[model samples]
Target: MVMLFESSTIKNITIKNRVMMAPMCMFSVEKEDGIVTPFHLTHYESRALGQVGLIMVEATSVTADGRISPLDLGIWSDEQIEGLHTLTSRIHAHGSTAAIQLGHAGRKAKTNQPAYAPSAVAFSEDEAIPTEMNEEKVTETIDAFKAAALRAKESGFDIIEIHGAHGYLINQFLSPLANTRTDRYGGTREGRYQFLRETITAIQSVFEGPLFVRISAEEYHKDGNTMDDFIYFAKEMKKQGVDLIDVSTGGLVQAPIDVFPGYQVPHAETIKKAAQIKTSAVGLITSGRQAEEILKNQRADFICVGRALLNDPYWPKRAAEELGYVIEAPKPYARGWA
Candidate 1:
């Protein structure tokens, strides 16, 4: 039997299989207003129809200033609710659970507006230096996350993922390289992770479903956070009601990383074992056999397929065929599977 085709439960939600469409930013909002367009509907629905177990929407900003790009989607205002609701409805129609990744770009936001971070640091020398976050700003961001979670719940999403990776705002705070704050929100591990811990708590207040946190497990620099740091971070996340850790490495700062197939699998394995929490492994996981091997060896629970799905919307369907698991195709496309 193919374990990759097996159903897995995260909290109260049961996904149809272990194949997940990893969240990839689609900078196609058209007007830079952060509203969902027809492009988003077609893009995401195709993956659900492809038989992906979980379809995680890309990083959506909680506030206008938090957007990674002006064209990125937003869950900030009430106006975005209807379109998001329609999106979830369509994904659910195809038998795949829909999820959204809520995030803030902070110092990395590629907008004309001023950015905010744990300290006044620039992602690079050429980028704008971000303003250090004050207590009021921290509270506002937390409230924004809370409000976004509520909006996600209203939009009928089955899960909510906190984007704490890829050198974004949350990652910026957790990283000592980016965050040089002298307040309670910086310095020690507990201090560095305070923002994420509180954000999770705030999200739980409004959304009571499967919650996943994506983290950059390795910063790549010798002085940057290592696997041991992530293990401890994952443990703190578990304590705050996080159900899964979406493991990816690098992007905390620019450094050379040895990239190869399944390079991030060991990081996921270490966090899973040390933190005793479920993890989703991502990073160059392009084939079904590779995904199956990861599960077979108990490295991770979910295989997050990113660029592979973008290259082939029916990648999951192909994976099912390769694994010899008869996954149900959409009624109109059923004959193709036959």
Candidate 2:
């Protein structure tokens, strides 16, 4: 059995249990874009009460231009900060550590305004081509990440996760296939990583919470992004003070994935062993016994749960019960746990 009581830590934040909530997009918020809608509070509070060790809020755009979808939550302005405070406080009240994934969609952005990337590439599925960014726009994006990190800190989250994986902006930069720029942000491997490196560095200037970057360890396309890329990216991030990597894969271009139980655990294992950084494993991890084995074998430091929990909100508590570990339920639900 995975030791249910085993605590997990990343930099300055400690989680009371091994299970973490993988960020799932709600895209449910008030029309103001930055403000929290009622749906977000209840959706997250239930997970908090369910006793997950840490809860990562869905990715919030670093700026309006960065939004993955128009309906996504954000903290680009002061107005967005207050509602997030309520979110953090509620998560804390349930004894769960709160985390948020800050992101920019890059060419993937589908908001009403024009989308942008290193080149004017359109996703195969989309009709509109993304506007390739100019030098000034790139610089401004970096600043936006920095300012967003500062605002997230002000919102009282215990940890900060950069959205580097799943074919987002940073992932675009990481892949040789998508980025063919001739500027400082392109060409060689070091050049490809320049955008992500700069983004993390700029965010570091304003925030010091546990820094976690979500990464797609493998790109499904063998030549597109190499495991060698992951090795290099992981080491560089650690050197730049990245505390943990939330390891997941295959969001490049929305293609179908061939997956099995714990298919992505190898990515976590590879990074933990090679880069010497803490890592969290996601993708089809559903049960306590499976999760425990991964931790015991040193495959992953933390277990990130997604869809399974959506199926059963008390998945953690039930897993503990099944594994012969005693865990307390919230008072309102204590009798059932007992």
Candidate 3:
């Protein structure tokens, strides 16, 4: 049976193990220029040195106004390439493949700049109603995703994960609750998914490496997208050359979601079985035994360790020991681990 320590490969890239670092926003850019800082280099390298299989960088903006916050990283311009390239080189040097989550926060964007969305709606009462995106604007955003993909390739990322989850721009378009447009980009499920399809097509044009899409499978609202809806999306993503579906939930609306260990694992398992695509289970997955069971049961191809990894960069190394798997630690750390 596949275990957490066993390596997994997607397309041409091989991951050292099943422990993937989920993309979490850092909001650490001191200059607000969207360029990565030395903090990012150190933060990611620590995970790589800790033996995480794949280190996915935080949600990086594809456009100036697409950032979730002014402090988020940006890839809309070529100037940011140097920092990202440096990051990828460090990750590779330490035996981990680097990946990045390209995203546009859309109406959820908290920057001072005006936000854009499929519909002219506000994420909440305090937030401003965003300008509805016309065809021209939509095309511009898609082009941005394409440009960002090329930048990711140039930066040497082994995988490009489209951040379509967490109530971001793509999720805003996908969720009926946030999108009430009557145009071609809304109304029906296919219409709601059109933006993502176009974005994927655009990215695939330049990126030949493994592609992944993270989606909020359960919107937590009665009228929002459901498991079946996500399965359909997973199938569509497969047709669009998506190598994996990063399964996450409950970012479409501000509803209370009960938290528990492995709450989102079933969503990943369901999508993997129905959509016939590889998947990564995320959320509250904190231990090696839990991750191993999920893989052994064929629920997911990878286990995304989020907050646990943040809390302890060496979480994976500790997990390996707990599972009785002797994962090779870095030479200097080997004596301490021994």
lDDT by residue for model 1 (68-160), tens: 999999999999999999999999998999999999998888876889999998888778788999999999999999999999999999999
Q: What lDDT score is found at residue 244 in candidate 3?
A: 96
TM-score of candidate 2 to 2 decimals: 0.96
**Clash totals in order:** 0, 1, 0
Residue 275 of model 2 has an lDDT of: 95
Each prediction's TM-score against the native? 0.98, 0.96, 0.98
Regarding lDDT, does 1 or 2 come out ahead?
1
Arrange candidates, best lDDT first.
Answer: 3, 1, 2
Predictions in order: lDDT: 0.92, 0.87, 0.93
For model 2, the superposed segments whose C-alpha errors exceed 4 Å read: none
Residues 1-338 of candidate 3 have per-residue lDDT tens digits of 33898888889999989999999999999899989899999999999999999999999999989889999999999999999999999999999999999999999888888899999988878778899999999999999999999999999999999999989899999989999988888988899999999999999999999999999999888889877788888999999899999999987678899999999999999999999999999989999899999999999999999999999999997898788878887999878988
Which portions of model 3 miss their true places by more than 4 Å?
Answer: none
lDDT of 3 at 133: 92
Model 1 regions lying over 4 Å from their true place = none
RMSD of each: 0.9, 1.4, 0.9
